[model samples]
Target: MTLEILTADTLAPVRHGFFTRAGGASSGVFSGLNCGTGSSDQTEIVEINRARVADAMGVDASHLIGVHQIHSADAVHVTGPVTTKPKADGLVTRTPGLALSVLTADCQPVLLADAQSGVIGAAHAGWKGAQAGIVEATVDAMVALGAIRSQIHAVIGPTISQRAYEVGPEFFEEFMDEGPENARFFAGGDGDRMHFDLPGYGLSRLRAAGIASAEWTRHCTYFDPHRFFSYRRSVHEKAPDYGRLIATIVL
Candidate 1:
């Protein structure tokens, strides 16, 4: 199968994609474009998958840079490929030849680009990273690279939606502890469980960062087994491991 790349018109002139698990070399649980080097998939296969993504972004495989994704409000500024990926959740680059990639199973993979400033960024935003302000941090980093936050366009890729993201009371408390206004992002679930709108929260954060425009692609990773890899779905099904989908943006 050919690689399935989801794009948005809002990010005009930026070579970006939300890659699905349609075309890759891996098999079993970690099948289809598992570009996550941290995954249990074969290292060689992961390299091949990442190379495919890099090619699609019109850059050398080595130019596709990623981070350790610690789910924190950290962003790295990249000028060139590194021998070792840094321990950060977001990456911003003013370099034209580089592509920033973010790996996620159910977490939001957000791509930001400012074609006028020749700056682009990618962020891994799980609940922790999003709540901790990773999205705002990425926008700020892009501005330091000469990208106007008002000129930046951010689009969130595939992720688990609220209807599929059942959470415990403790999970709700975590958000409440941060701020009580966050309660609007949740809905009633079974008993004390609540459904969190992760993608919605991601967009809210991006918009709050003063980005000109931001939106989610409406692709739910947990609900769609054929197109995505979902960590929560894997756990629910009792799978040993889950695959990761890669989203990339090149300047």
Candidate 2:
């Protein structure tokens, strides 16, 4: 199958994509474009997948850079590919000929660019990273690279949606502790379970960070088995491991 890449108009001019689980060499549980080097999937196969992504972004495989993604708010500025990945959830670069990428299963894969300033960034924003301010941190990193706060456009790619994101009272309380207004991002689920609108919360964070425009691709990873890889869905199915989707942006 050909690669299925989802794009947002808000981030136009820059080559960016939210790649689906298609056009890859892996099989069984980690099938389809599992670009995560950290996965149990064969390292060679993962490298192949990442090379495909790098090609799509018009860069050499070595020019495609990613972080360790510790689910923190940390963002790093990069000028080129590194021999070792940094411990960060976000990456920003103003340099040309470099691609910034992130791996996600159900987490938000956020791509941001200020084409006018020649700045681009990619972020891995699971709930922990999002709540900790990954989006804001990414925008700030871009700004430090010469991107204007009001010129940056951000897009949250495929992720688990609210209807599929059932959470415990502790999760709900944790967000509430951040702010009572966060209640707006949740809906009542079965009994004490609450459904969290992760994409909605992500957009809220982007706008709050003063991004000129932000949008979600509206593709739910948990709901689309053929096109996406979902960590939560894999757990529910009792699968041993799940593929990580790759999202990339290049300058």
Name the candidate that leads on lDDT.
2
How many clashes show up in model 1?
A: 0
Candidate 1 TM-score to native: 0.98
- Model 1 residue 208 distance off true place after TM-score fit, in angstroms: 1.1
Q: Write one digit per residue (lDDT tens) for candidate 1, span 119-138.
A: 89999999999989999999
Off by over 4 Å in 2: none
Worst 10 residues of 1 by lDDT: 30-39
- lDDT for model 2: 0.93
Error of 1 at 190 (Å): 1.0
Q: What is the C-alpha lDDT of each candidate?
A: 0.92, 0.93
TM-score of each model, paired residue for residue:
0.98, 0.99
Candidate 2, 1-251: lDDT as tens digits: 77889999888889989999899989899888898788899999998988888888889999989999899999999988799999999999988998898999999999999999999999999999999999999999999888999999999999999999999999999999999999999999889999999999999999998879999989999999999999999999999999999999997
